[model samples]
Target chain A: MSSEVRRIRYSPPWGDASIIGVAGSSGSGKTSLALAIVASLNLPWVVIMSMDSFYKPLNAEQSAIAFRNEYDFDSPEAIDFDILVDRLRDIKQGRVAEIPIYSFEKHNRIEKTTSIYSPHVLILEGIFALHDQRVLDLLDLKIFAEADADLCLSRRLVRDVKERGRDIEGCIKQWFGYVKPNFYKYVSPQREIADVIIPRGIENTVAISMVSGQIQKTLAHKSAQHQEQLQRLGKIAEDAPLSPNAIILPQTNQVKGIHTLLMDPKTSTEEYIFYFDRLVTLLVEKAVDFLPSHPEQVITPAGNVYMGLKTSVGTSAVVILRGGSAFETGLRRTIPDCRTGRILIQTNYRTGEPELHYRALPKNIAEDGLVLLLDPQMSSGGAALMAVRVLVDHGVPEDRIVFVTYLAGPVGVNRVLSVFPEVRVVVARMGDDMEERWVESRYLGC
Target chain B: MTDNTAPSQSVGPEYLPIGRKPTATVSTNLAHDNVTILPQTSQLIALLTMIRDKNTGRADFIFHSNRIIRLLVEEGLNHLPVVEHTITTPVGRTYSGVKFEGKICGVSIMRAGESMEQALRECCRSVRIGKILIQRDEETSKPKLYYDKLPEDIAERWVLLLDPMLATGGSALMAVEVLKSRGVPEDHILFLNLIASPEGAKNFAERFPKVRVVTAFVDMGLDEKNYIVPGLGDFGDRFYTM
Candidate 1:
């Protein structure tokens, strides 16, 4: 049998300055194709930057036109290409950038945003990504995912109807009058610059696979470079003495006593319960001492009340459900009827990301109070760091969080501290020598 | 035989709650070995047969699950080292063997986890079993906790954590997190499951080496969903009689 001619899949840049531009007309499946490539290559460091996220905030005039479907959305000027260029540059340099949120319905940028931090493979996709000279210069590899004009228009029509909540009349008018001409003038011209063209976009699984294979090679190259840089950073972090920011709980005789009680094999269940309750009380007490407090006074039963300052325990309540709920005993015993909220961070093994299963926090978690993040064990500290980051991103001050865990390994503690050094952490005991793994192996003596 | 290096135990009753003033007495020396992890003959027989049978329905699947849970829980409780106690009999004579030190609670990882609750309650009287719902992602097959409600002072009680199936061990691990976050000491928790896969059990053991897993049967493999191979179909679906 004669060998088939293999397509040349576009390769991402090897060095740090390289950018990968995903460009195609609307509904060409550029985003879908990019995602497949990113995943197949296990390119966790890659950031998929949607050009839609950089859409300019609509001015009042444009807002009115947007409402009336008279705005020129398909034009390159509609996007904030300058900001997109800056973000791509920042990410390439290993700097974090706040990626804008694009609201499809209001047809403008949203107030909320997601930050892209230190991504190596920047999958910059949008209709106009390849149109701008500044962006084009930065891109090491250019891709054009193409589809038939009729097919693109039909797909866009359906997407707008289902996701964008647009009527067929508006979609047809927008596509025929504005989008059609813009594609020919702006998006189609970029085809000459593309190192690789994906025909039929996502439908051509073979093409996607080839591109993905290239991405893997690119990631492997970049990973070696990154690992070297990481080694340098680790040496730097090691040479620099532990920051005062890491507040270690005092390892005292009482602490060792408790640890001994916990570690003891012959300790009766009754003794176990007693020591555990006592230890938890102490741990909670110590954790509260770390909470931000302000001076306040309380009246006594006698005529004269004691003049003592109360800790400025922010008005926000504690929130822990699922595993978090177990702390209520100590919290109630110490804080006495403290208001509480719940957030469910469940792991979906398939995705390996802790999905927010449920969230019912107080209306003003960010504004009102200091949050005491309580958990029993922290191995990887991924969930804890993410939870704390979520609160901070939503406006909670870094200093307002007091994280307490019953047991913490060195790796998880280091991970949490490295990410959020400002947050106070207290653990009854620290297992300094440990490695965190997700899969559990059982004993099946052969 | 198993590794029998029991954790050190404190002699007297010591009660302290971290971050809070003491409320009730807490005896801390609850050794991990206190929870007996025995190989159950009947449950293993059931598990092997169920996994072997191609035509096993939801009902039979659930029955086997309950059977496995009951035997595992029994084994776990047997390992709970008890203190000697004596009470006056009608004949004015006293006798003593052993008595549990404190309250016990069952925290079930939801859905399939809830299936283990009955077996736990049957073994421990007035046991408070909490619920933590961790759903697996359709794409990743990882366990994600969707909802959870737990006891006030889980740290003070002996917690029997029940989840019928542990595949990749993601859900079980996260369930441990929920407990840890709530201040349950690593040794305070006992993870019980009807079936486990080698990959999952190995991963979990490496992360929390001190914690123990008492499983009825260790399956040989995991499918894409991380479901135990030759494993009965989704325990949650089957246990719910879906």
Candidate 2:
């Protein structure tokens, strides 16, 4: 295995989230500009991560200053750039990042946090969105929303009075004392680095459309790379022998009997469903048997000590939907109380690329002792690879995952294992790598 | 069980065409304990008519049958217990409501039984499903369990036993026995089907008095072929082959 080693990884369309920094003076419509771009794109994956969420908690003196409307919140020093940059980097690398929630009314950070993951485009909008060098390095597009100074102050007065409950005098006090001055000292300088300067903010339809177009283009390019990477891995997998981690159930008569019935086209749908389900249950049991366990003594009903073993960690499963739906019966059979998460990765008809349509994973799946990726069959392993990548991205360790399938071609098995050598593959039988997926439809009957 | 749990709608009996009601022909079968036949409504009758007609094409058959199956599943869900739940509204007010008290899963009898699986899925998100195959032993010529894949925690969940047709009731009885062996309470199991013969209904309710049977239509009786008359012929064959 060590003699011919090659490492490859599949990157989803949102793998490297394009960070777009929207910086401008307070009340200049930075948020509105981000919203406009998102509205034009009309995509669910374009997330607007407000830099306001990263506002640093204030000490007693600073809190008092903030209460008096004398705090320089518009300045770069007032924002926690270190934490902001750390999270931005995590998003850029397609990893989970917890963003702190700040309360402007309380002038402090809240105890709870919100998380960001798998965003196709993240609009980092705030007065100092582009001030940090580290942030500038991660940003793919830099936008500066501009408006007249008088207009900015008036918008601030209306917003503070209605939403923040600020008195008119204090709003004016902060406008001149901190916000106005900070715009010149720290916020205004960011415009020099901005790629697009849109005056009148959201009213600039041409600018918003341009920004949205660029983002769509970037996404299309990333999707192309993902498809190419999958094919590259497949080519490597095609020539290699099955990974040692790919474990096939022993060819017992029971296993063979089930497979024979399943492979026979003349078999009635009733018998096909029966045998396929039987095979799936056996596959799940085989996967469970592979989980690490420790032996202990327990008192039996006969008043005698019995030696038994228990798995060291709680196991959860992620069902790759549609096809994975076929495994629901078997999965319940093996672990009736098992927590299950679902990920739907559908192969695009036009491109033969597996695109992730939806995912709802169990909480803290990365911490699970074992995570089984359930799919009834694997041919080219396109969906399986994407599904595994999802779990790994969500924090599940590669080694802790076991790809459970009723039938898998050698190419598909090798493809998944070659990319994730540590992960184990539990299969019932092996056949044509390019075989059309018929079992999920056969079993699901839809 | 009485009709108290039946969900009422503004679309009333006035809409049902005369002499075309689900309850009309199945009154005799309803005398069996723990059996609930779907209420008579023109919408349901129309769907049954499309499926039962021999001239109905495959696409029409599947589409109409699925609609009826969806209704059967919704009715089946009414039997599940619910607990009062209080939730706060976004307007800073709280309202009391009810939520399902326990988890539920579907256990489909293979082939024809799998037809109901999709309907159950449409009603419940990520609901776990199990499968049981009880076919004749061939040698002994008796219904024997070939395989059963039940959830590990089935004993704790209300099991929706799915099979499209109920005729002779041998396979269903064997399936119920399998559930009992797995520690599932008889009352917790709801046998959901599209149609059932009178003989099968009587035989099933008598064998397991606690397991409720919820069917869309109860046909007159079984024919010599042991198939439900006026019932869509060979549910598994029609469902899969079509």
Candidate 3:
């Protein structure tokens, strides 16, 4: 198998796993066929779990009857379905499961149990595997192994006599009395649910190969879909021209000086904080200019009317957490009475997906004439997108929201603008490289 | 002559100006871009602060309310349509300038809306004025139009719908319906208010998207009593000393 396929096969617990279930009556070679497929796949991450391990431990009287071939083990009621369903669900969710070990000779569970963790491929082989609805629901693929009734009985006779230490007459009588009747009643009916039927059981190598190929194709498709989603999230409009919705503050010497301090690697944390404050003030001031204003005339001290512009409405500011909080002081300084709200969004370290941890906005923030969305830095724009979605869902008008950031990449800004075109974006500086500083600081671990 | 044969491109039953699409399409939410919130100028903010203060007496309240309303009306008129014209300067040189286009009219939703009428008339002298008396049924909370007196040729004029407070937009919507019934196109109407709640503005825009909304400020939302919170309490009650 290719390394990419292997990576998926041994992916994290939350990753998708392909579950194949094989079902057939005794002596139908269901276990043998499952083993052959596993070996052919040559996947160390594949796990095979036999249904025999789910058999209910028998009482002394029941054990004696089972040993004497008087007790029927082929019935669905003979298996502990509750435990089996629980373990299957656990494995499906990438969790560890403890499977019981059953001894056929003792007709009971052994003292020890086998711990099974999540695997890329999970195979469940048994006569009643397809009988339970719960088990069938968890399986991605179901295969039924079939053989001639006479041939199955002959094989059963040989195996029971040698491996099981059962006499010929006893095996024959038990097969006719319990096994054959139960197989027709319960196990044979499950063929209707089988996705693929192998007529010759283990000897049907062609059918096994086809089932394996189908599973591999499904896995490949899932992997491709996951990659596409990641690409969509990370995509930035680098080559495309800047969107009209973006408002890059004019590169004045003061603005450039602040950027120099912010971008310098040798700048101390205190100096970085101070310079960021200065930059944020400028960004907030620029964003305020976007609000609607009207011309006004006021009497001057010289008894002359002077025409001026006056702001028309109130504004509210919503800051994204951590980095976004840097703009809080600047926003307050600019609009002292402006209501402030906060949204906490963090990137999951393992999954790299942004998660909203918390959000607190002023009551009736939706009605505010303007909402200033503050985030100091935007890399992939994933967190900003999520924050914007939150505001939009709360009935805030998209165009009324002005997303203010100190520094942003072209990709992040474009990503947000594409999703929310009407939302205005104001940034002090626009950079092409998103992760250069982080990489230099060893924050991203290269 | 009424051009009834003109193709109706508007989404609603009311006629809108040709070639002007509804502004709601600019965003999925209420058209915020079409709604202009005046900047927080110190003079305006100071007046608003005085009006919102509980300790302010009726005289001060009325004085500040009128000042703010006049400022808001002046600001609102700036959004009205204008046409270019040329005139001879005293120096005998031709000066080109823009002049207000179309006739101007104001329809006030009584009694809160009546407070803004004086300011609107002050700015547009000799402007045609109209009144719409829509009272909320205290029990039902539904607006019932009791009376309306609009201009005869209102369809050809730019009508400014004036109200001091837009809480639930029930009265504003009724007033707009009355205006549209009078044959005034939605695009030719501008809804001007001192303060509005988001819900009220959203509801109004969703119903009459082509009409522009110019407000001094938008408070949070209405309380259970349907009054705007942090709002200058009941503009009509405070202005009339009721």
What TM-score does candidate 2 get on C-alpha atoms? 0.63
Listed in order, the DockQ scores are 0.01, 0.01, 0.01
Model 2, B1-242: lDDT tens per residue? Answer: 11212122222133223332222122234687589887644345445655665555776667667767866776777777765555542223343434456889999999789888876775564899999998988898789998989899999999999988888899999999999999999999999988887788888999899998999877655556676654666666666785
Off by over 4 Å in 3: A1-230, A233-236, A295-297, A300-303, A436-446, B1-242
Q: Which stretches of candidate 1 lie over 4 Å from their true place?
A: A1-20, A35-50, A53-69, A81-124, A132-141, A161-170, A192-195, A214-257, A265-277, A297-302, A313-329, A335-403, A408-424, A430-432, A435-446, B1-242
TM-score of each: 0.48, 0.63, 0.34
- Give the alpha carbon lDDT tens digit for every residue of A1-446 in model 2: 42244656667677888999999989999888999999998866789999989989999999998998888787778889999999998899888789999988899999999988778789999998889888999999998999999989999999989988889999899888889888899888888999989899888898888999999998788878888888888899989988878888776434544555566555677767766765676677567644544433333222222223333577899999888888887677546778999988888899888877788889988887889999988999989887888888888888789999987899998888888887788998876677777877777676
Candidate 3 lDDT, B113-200, residue by residue in tens:
8888776654455788899999878888788999888888888989899998887899998898888888898998898888777778
- Give the per-residue lDDT digits (tens) of candidate 1, residues B60-167: 656555645665775565444455544432223333324456667889887778877776664454688898988778888666779989999888877888887777
Model 3, residue A368: C-alpha shift (Å):
1.1
Give the CA lDDT, 0 to 100, for residue A49 in model 1: 81
Best by TM-score: 2
Candidate 2 segments whose C-alpha is farther than 4 A from its true place = A1-6, A165-167, A263-273, B1-242
> What are the chain B TM-scores of all models?
0.75, 0.87, 0.84
Return the interface RMSD of model 2.
Answer: 28.8
**TM-score of model 1 (first chain only):** 0.65
* lDDT of residue B200 for candidate 3: 86
